[model samples]
Target: LIRGGRVELGDARDLPFTIKRSWARERLTPDVHPGGFVLGCNMTMHRDVAARIGYFDERFGAGGPLRSAEDTDYLVRAMLLGIAVEYVPDMTIFHHHGRRDRKAIEKLHRDYSLGNGGLCLKHVRH
Candidate 1:
């Protein structure tokens, strides 16, 4: 899955930072080679990766700090399963990060609290 708010579509030469283009511009270069080039782009992620590693844990809401790590945890699980995450430098989109409104935040807090409790119960039972 694409991470973070900023995204663009192009090769590394067109990047705002110093980057090398020829090195695996449309693939996961860092996983393949330490010195290989990298690209930052918005991707419509293929479903094959999730077909094995499972989907995001919707239990955590955005407001809770620990909730933020849920995505990281999912990505880590994906990497453990030997899924190759490719960074397509030629296609990108800038995401707009949105915060919840006050009411939304309050509702999220309640949901998050219940979700964490459920998680604890599951672990305890397991």
Candidate 2:
């Protein structure tokens, strides 16, 4: 939408990637590596994983004060705890966000940036 066109999101974020399981399942701190992100709207996980991570941080949710990055925060938390986190392409959901205009998309980007900044600060503080 910010790019000035019809935002057909079918392939907007999905990209071909190769992920290798880390032999040493240990981490010094939480980090969002490449291929570690998944859309919150389409996020799916085993009940155990959810229970382990203690669920999404509402503070980072789109409607919350942070305004975005709940999914990324969840993923990073899982990784830091040594819980498996992967991006599964086959498991998909059709999200019709209807952001067909530049103004809407630009706003979305701005909101996302704000949320991302908050997320970073949260992690750094911890």
Which candidate wins on lDDT?
2
Encode model 1's per-residue lDDT on 1-126: one tens digit a residue: 432222532343332331233323453422442111222223234676566777666653354443433443444455556655555544435433233256655654565456456444433333
- The candidate scoring highest on TM-score is 2
Could you give candidate 2's per-residue lDDT for residues 22-85 as a string of tens digits? Answer: 2233222334341234556655667776787895788887679887777667766766677665
Off by over 4 Å in 2: 1-36
> Which parts of model 1 are misplaced by more than 4 Å?
1-43, 59-65, 98-126
Q: Which pairs, if any, clash in model 2?
A: none
**C-alpha TM-scores of all predictions:** 0.41, 0.69
**Candidate 1 at 57: error in angstroms?**
2.0
Clashes of each: 1, 0
Worst 10 residues of 1 by lDDT: 34-43
TM-score of 1: 0.41
